[model samples]
Target: MKAAEIRSKTVDQLNDDLASLKKEQFNLRFQKATGQLEKTARVKQVRKDIARIKTIAAEKSAGKKA
Candidate 1:
């Protein structure tokens, strides 16, 4: 998913998306360990997406605190 799309989501939606991405990341790791992962690039993409979501979430929280 694009950062713009992710940023448009509400915090609750972002949390849900983050959770699902984490789950997918876990499964991808196992697949990689077993040499079954066809789309290795997906792992990198997911990691970046997770980071983006966390960053956005932190920004949102900080905005609220301010």
Candidate 2:
């Protein structure tokens, strides 16, 4: 997902998205370990998306605090 798209989501939604991404990341790791991961690039993509959500979430929270 794009940063702009992530930024549009509310904090609660972002949290939910982050949780789901983490679950998917876990599953992907299992797949990789078993040598069944066809789309290995997805693991990297999900990791980046998780980071994007987290960064935007932090920015939003900091904005609120300020």
Strongest candidate by lDDT: 2
**Tens-digit lDDT track for model 1 on 1-66?**
888898798999999999999999999999999999999999999999999999999998899899
Q: Deviation in angstroms for 40 in model 1?
A: 0.6
TM match of model 1 to true structure:
0.95
Off by over 4 Å in 1: none
- State every prediction's TM-score relative to the real structure: 0.95, 0.98
Pairs that clash in candidate 1: none
**Deviation in Å, model 2, residue 56 alpha carbon:** 0.3
lDDT at position 5, candidate 1? 92
Q: Which ten residues in a row have the lowest lDDT in candidate 2?
A: 3-12
**What does each candidate score in C-alpha RMSD?**
0.7, 0.4
Give me the candidate number with maximum TM-score: 2
Query: Which residue pairs of candidate 2 clash?
Result: none
